[model samples]
Target: MLSATPRTSLGREKHRGSTDRNDLYQVLDTGLVCHLGVVADGHPMVVPTCYGRVGDTLYLHGSTGARSLRAADGAEVCVTVTHLDGLVLARSIFSHSVNYRSAVVYGRARLVTDPDERMDGLRALSEQLVPGQWDYARRPSRKELAATAVLALSLEEASVKIRQGAPEDEDEDYALPVWAGVLPLVTAWGKPEPDPVLPEGIETPVHILRRE
Candidate 1:
């Protein structure tokens, strides 16, 4: 069961909320990007960024000089990942909504200082973005590693909300001639475009060529 902290509890649309830890993992695992929210200069700021999850921890990295990462380090931050599945159409305008799976996590991020953990976190990030790339590419050098910063946040406190299937229309409106159904959305990887300066004999790796 997932923990229900004050911030993780859903205030509204409780029916759509999920308490299953697997559901939370599923949402996070499938998402490509997450929005990290932090308080900077007395104002809330949100940044779109790529992330990687390993077990119960989520890792985020950026340049050491980044203001958002610097300000959010060791502070309470909220990370959210959402996937749009479809557009729900109802007879009434107010009843219309989107079918989506979203997860919000609240925790205090700790800047990763250990060299081993930092390298492992970076590997996780690379593998998450592109499977098998971490092994395919060269490792980071000391100078490059010094310029990057990684933050680790626990996934213990999180909220998962999923809206799926068709829209719910009122009984009175069901008799109306208005058409209503869901318009599904799909996401997939496109054809790979090779680098122009690549060696003539070099071929696309299977990990990238088979991406879908």
Candidate 2:
């Protein structure tokens, strides 16, 4: 079950809140990018970045010189991953809404320093972005690793909210002639385009080509 911390608790739309921890994992895993919320220089900053999950830990990586990463390390932060499933069109504009799966995690993100764990975190990050590319592409060198910063945030305190199905409108509004239904938003991978400078014989990798 997810923690019921005050920050994680949903004061409104309680029915949309999910206590199942798996739902939290599902929301994070399906999403490609996460919005990292942190307080930098006494100002709130929300940055969209790529992330990876390993067990209950979420890994965020960027250049060591990035101010967001610098401020997030050793400080409390909020990370959110959301997937918009559909648009809910109702008979009345007041009832308009969206179907989405979202998860918000709250914890103190720590900068990873252990060499082995750092590599593992980086590997997880790379694998999350492209499954088989880590093995197929050239690995990072020592200097590259030194310039990168990885932060690990625990998923111990989090919240998951999911909304689906048709829109809900007022009793009288439902009887109107206006159409009310959900327009699902589907995301699909397009055909892979190779680099312009690549050798002619080097074809697109099987892992990328097989993505759906």
Tell me the spans in candidate 2 whose CA falls farther than 4 Å from its real position: none
Give all TM-scores, in the order shown.
0.98, 0.98
Give lDDT tens digits, candidate 2, residues 1-212.
99998999999999999999999989988888999999988999999999999999999999999989989999999999999999999999999999999999999999999999888888888888889988999999999999999999999999999999999899989679998899999999988888889988988888999975
TM-score computed on alpha carbons, candidate 1:
0.98
Give the CA lDDT, 0 to 100, for residue 68 in model 1. 90
Cα deviation of 200 in candidate 2 (Å)? 1.0
RMSD of each: 0.8, 0.8
Cα error, candidate 2, residue 28 (Å): 0.8
User: For candidate 1, what is the total of clashing residue pairs?
Assistant: 0
Backbone clashes under 3 angstroms, per model: 0, 0
lDDT of each residue in 66-144, candidate 1, tens digit only: 9999888999999999999999999999889999999999999999999999988898888888989999989899999
Candidate 1 regions exceeding 4 Å error are: none
